[model samples]
Target: MKTSILRWLLDPLTSLLALWLWSRDRGRRPYDAVWRLARVTRHPDELLYRVHGHRPDDPGDALP
Candidate 1:
């Protein structure tokens, strides 16, 4: 419960940050940027992946 609440709070902030950073890049697709940013999170799927295009199970998309 506590973790869920924390994630709810932080997700938006990180997403906004990712979009801002993505805007600056101008070369990356929005979904790609979100995926890159979301990779740092404990659970990317719960954040921006659903709204964006990429699925966590994509063949080569796993985080290193």
Candidate 2:
């Protein structure tokens, strides 16, 4: 079906985005990545240092 095709197409993109967000560098630990993604989406202030637009860390930014 059309939805299945769309899901297949978007799944990789979603995975890639999660990888990018969860990854600090190319050498990302898979478990850490998943945990980070979940943590950031739910309670960003708890674990995430910063997340502002395209910049993950800006000097002007402060963590909670």
Candidate 1 structure quality by residue, lDDT tens digits, 3-61 = 33554476766555555666777746664545356545645556644544455656577
State the lDDT of candidate 2 residue by residue for 1-64, as single tens digits.
Answer: 6743553375655445555665655555453345445445655675544232336465567555
Off by over 4 Å in 2: 1-29, 50-64
Q: Which stretches of candidate 1 lie over 4 Å from their true place?
A: 1-10, 38-64
Supply the TM-score for candidate 2: 0.26
Q: What is the lDDT of residue 30 in candidate 2?
A: 54
Candidate with the greatest TM-score versus the true structure: 1
In order, what lDDT does every prediction score?
Answer: 0.56, 0.50
Residue pairs in candidate 1 whose N, alpha carbon or C atoms collide under 3 angstroms: none
